[model samples]
Target: MTTLSQSGGRRLIDLVPHIVLIVGVLIFAFPIYVTLIGSTWDSATIGRGNLPLTPGGEALVNYGQAWSESHGARASYTPVRVMLLNSLVMALTIALGKIAISIISAYAVAFFRFPFRMAFFWMIFITLMLPVEVRIIPTYKVVADLGLIDSYAGLTIPLIASATATLLFRQFFLTIPDELVEAAKIDGAGALRFFVDVVLPLSKTNIAALFVILFIYGWNQYLWPLLITNSADMETIVIGITKMIGTGEAANDWNLIMATTVLAMLPPIAVVVLMQRWFVKGLVDSEK
Candidate 1:
């Protein structure tokens, strides 16, 4: 009886964690669930606060309308399709740019011994303390002065150089065996050839991880994109979604807003799901 009781107690204790985890997941996911359900209902139903748990009949209509064109109750009449494309371009550009710049920055610092290299690296690192909020005005002014305002260059260029990615890549590069470096050098491979062959292949997981993170970062950008682009077609999906809501007696098309929100979520979700393995390995695994 005592042994049986102890076993049962252990099982109960184990079950407690699973129960807590399930509850936590439900708590986080509930808002998404509500948004999803609300997207299917009409504006009148939502405005009347009839937030049904089950999806309603207006799913197709809401999504179709959101996809093709804005309700224009709040913001521009630009189609969500154009906004989505803009967002995709911005996100891809930022991700690829950050990766390209960071990897090269890290490679130079890690492999080459130069005057004040560490100082330069620390200078790059110091930028981390200065968040976007601190640099926004000057960045905006510079971008405007450079004739890049309302352009893709303004949207992506100011945001691409990432100290964090550089730091991460540098750390990873440091872990590489010295013997490998020596062997590559002995084979008469130039710096570029060695980097292309040896370094990049090993950094694959890390690159994938940073790409996912940077892509999401760019995709969810609100303030910078909002400030940079005019409130027109160049606006990203995030800006578009926010613009869809009405304020102060301007009757909102809640259905369309929710549909846009749902659409906005999909790309990032797809990225995370598809890159789950590489992302996890890059972040957690130390093995080369």
Candidate 2:
């Protein structure tokens, strides 16, 4: 009996983590499932307050309307398609721009022994301590002065130069053997050529990892986009989704709102899922 009880206790211990994982998955997934089902119903069905547990047959109609029609009772009629495109552009631009700029900054800082290099790096590092909210007013003024508000450059440029990415690349660059640099120079490879061919290839993993992170960060931006883009056509999906759901005092088309929400979330999720392998590899390699 003692032996049997010990074996059973060990089995229970082994099963505990799986049980917790399953419960955690359910806890997170239930709301998404509800959102998915909610999107399939009609506005009347959703607006009634009691949400349905089952999927409705109106999935196609709801999604079609969401993709094409104006959301809420707002006078502006920005389609979800336009919002999706805007978000894609903002996310891609931010990711690529940050990586490009960070790579160059990291290369310069890591490879070159110039005066005030550390000072410049520390200046950037200091900016990371100041969150965007702290500098919002000044940033807006600059963007406004440049006449970039409601434009893609306005949405992306301010957010692209990441100290974090620069630090990551800088660290990774430091790990590169000095022999490679000497070898490249001996082989008559210029700085630009070595950077383009050697350093870039070595940094692919870090790039992919940073892309995933920056893409999501850009995609989920709410405050900046909200303040910058006055035009409905320029609004990103994250901000546009808010315009879909009416204020609590007003009537909201819950079905349409939920559908739009799902659509807004898909691209980031797809990006992370597709690039997960490279993302993981990049993160691991960058740590060295």
Candidate 3:
């Protein structure tokens, strides 16, 4: 009877956490739901304080107007298309670069021993404590000197080396058995060969998780891109959206702004949802 009661209590504890999580999810999701419904309405209707319950078949018209006005209103260029392509290029470059550098660096640190090894590791790890806001001005100057401003390189290169990626890969690498490396060496396998054949195969979950994270980070970067990009042609979706919202004394198109915001969020949401399985697997593997 005591054992049964203990199990019941433990189960109830677990149930409490799950119930709390569900409530939190709903609370966060409410704004997104509101925005989605608001995207289908015009400024006048939304201003009347009507909660976006149903789109009432106005979705098409709202989307069309938002796209046309924010983009090339007179057939010059589509803001959505341009900003999307810019975001894709920037996000993919940063994600791939961060992953590549992080994997190589983490593998080296984890497997090889050399002078200043701990120092080097600590130096990199310490970078994580410093926020990007502190270094933005210097970073901007460096990029400007390199003539990367208003270019893809300017947008992507500065974001390539992430301390977080290095830390994550290092933790994942530590979880790998040393015996595997020894076995590879016994078979006359070189470092590159071992990494390619053994380490990478086991790291799929970690890599997938890292890719999703870095992709989201790169995709959502706004301040850096805004500061560096002087041309509308070079602006990202977030910047374009901000421009739409307008400053004081300028009329803000709330309906179009909301519509664009919803559209801008689609790619990230799709990525998370699609890769959710891998993300869960990564977390589980990390715990193990």
Candidate 4:
């Protein structure tokens, strides 16, 4: 009876946090739910605050109009589609480049001990403390000098190296056993072969987690892209979305705006959901 009571008490303790978390999740998600529902209505109805709990007739019509007019009032270009593609290309390029560079850099740092090793690592770590906003001016100048402004290189090249990814991979690599490295070396495996066959195989989870993080970061980039990209063809999804909201004299089309917002969010949401298993596994492995 005492053991049974103890088990029950333990179960209750575990349940308490989950219950609280679910309530908190609901609180946060309610607004997004409202926005999604609001997207299905006509702008006038949304402006009038007559948004229904359930979506009605206005969803398809507003979505169609939003898709059609996303470029501008003149409707010369489809801004949404262009911006979507730009964001995807930029995000994927950055994610892949960062991962490639970080994996190599991190493996070197984690596995090799050379002169001024700690100093080099510390210098790299220091970059993490400097905000990207602080470096924007110099970055812009460099991009302008290289004629990368208003080009894909301007959007993707500067962000190819990520301090966070390097640090995350370094931590994970440090946790791996030295015996494995020694064994690989004894088997005539060079550094490249060891890294490719041993380290990378073990780092699948970490790589997946990093990919998701960097992808989201690149996708949500607005200020930098806005600063660099002069052409409408070069604008990202986030920048396009902000421009969709009109100024004071102009009437804002809330329905179309909300619909575009919803569509813009779908990719990141899908990415996270699809990779959730790997994300969770990465967290577990990191803990181990």
Top candidate, metric lDDT: 1
Summarize candidate 1's per-residue lDDT along 55-120 as a digit string, tens digits: 899999888988996553444446779899999999999999999999999999999999999999
Measured on C-alpha atoms, candidate 2 has an lDDT of 0.88
Clashes of each: 0, 0, 1, 0
Inter-residue clash pairs, candidate 3? 71-79
Residue 167 alpha-carbon offset, candidate 2, angstroms: 0.7
Query: Which prediction has the highest TM-score against the true structure?
Result: 1
lDDT of 4 by residue, 73-96 (tens): 322334466778999999999999
Q: Cα deviation in Å at residue 279, candidate 1?
A: 0.8
RMSD to true structure for each model, in Å: 1.5, 2.1, 3.5, 3.1
lDDT of 2 by residue, 1-288 (tens): 999999999999999999999999999999899999999988777767777798899899878988998754423346889999999999999999999999999999999999999999999888889988999999999999999989999999999889999988898999999999999999999989999999999988889999999999999999999999998889899887787654453466777778888998899999999999999999775443
**Candidates 2 and 4 compared by TM-score, better number:** 2
TM-score of each: 0.96, 0.93, 0.87, 0.89
Q: Once superposed on the true structure, which residue ranges of model 1 sit more than 4 Å away at CA?
A: 72-77
Ranking by TM-score: 1, 2, 4, 3
